[model samples]
Target: MLQSVELASTSADVLIMAAAVSDWKPSDVSQQKIKKDG
Candidate 1:
């Protein structure tokens, strides 16, 4: 499973678990919109 939450309000242990949790994230993220410039 995956979750997203604010980091500041969370306790240390909870943040630890969130950090250690594993998920399939994309290998690359684009900084800007992709354009089909051919």
Candidate 2:
């Protein structure tokens, strides 16, 4: 994402981001890989 933003700044005059960001931290993180259930 950093590389993308840096590259875009060269050609574009302005950059507008409309993505939503989470302010809160997660309580628990899973160490194991999540399996896709089919």
Candidate 3:
């Protein structure tokens, strides 16, 4: 993501950053997809 932003900024006349900042980080992330039971 940082690389993309850097490359874009070089050619862009005006760079408008509209990305949101996360206040918190997740403690754990699942490696596999969780199955949902209906």
Instruction: Please name the candidate that would achieve the greatest lDDT relative to the true structure.
Output: 3
Clashing pairs in 3: none
Which digits, one per residue and each the tens of the lDDT, describe model 3 over residues 1-38? Answer: 99989987998799886745685566898899979999
Residue-level lDDT of model 1, residues 1-38, one tens digit each, is 33344545365455444343465576898999989998
How does model 2 fare in lDDT? 0.81
Best-to-worst lDDT order: 3, 2, 1
**Top-TM-score candidate index:** 3
What total of clashing residue pairs does each candidate reach? 0, 0, 0
| Clashing residue pairs in candidate 1 (N, C-alpha, C atoms within 3 angstroms) | none
C-alpha lDDT of all candidate models, in order: 0.58, 0.81, 0.82
Scanning candidate 1 in windows of ten residues, the lowest lDDT window is 12-21
lDDT of 2 by residue, 1-38 (tens): 88989987988988887755675566887899879999
User: What are the candidates' C-alpha RMSDs?
Assistant: 9.4, 9.7, 9.4
Candidate 1, 25: how far from true, in Å? 1.3
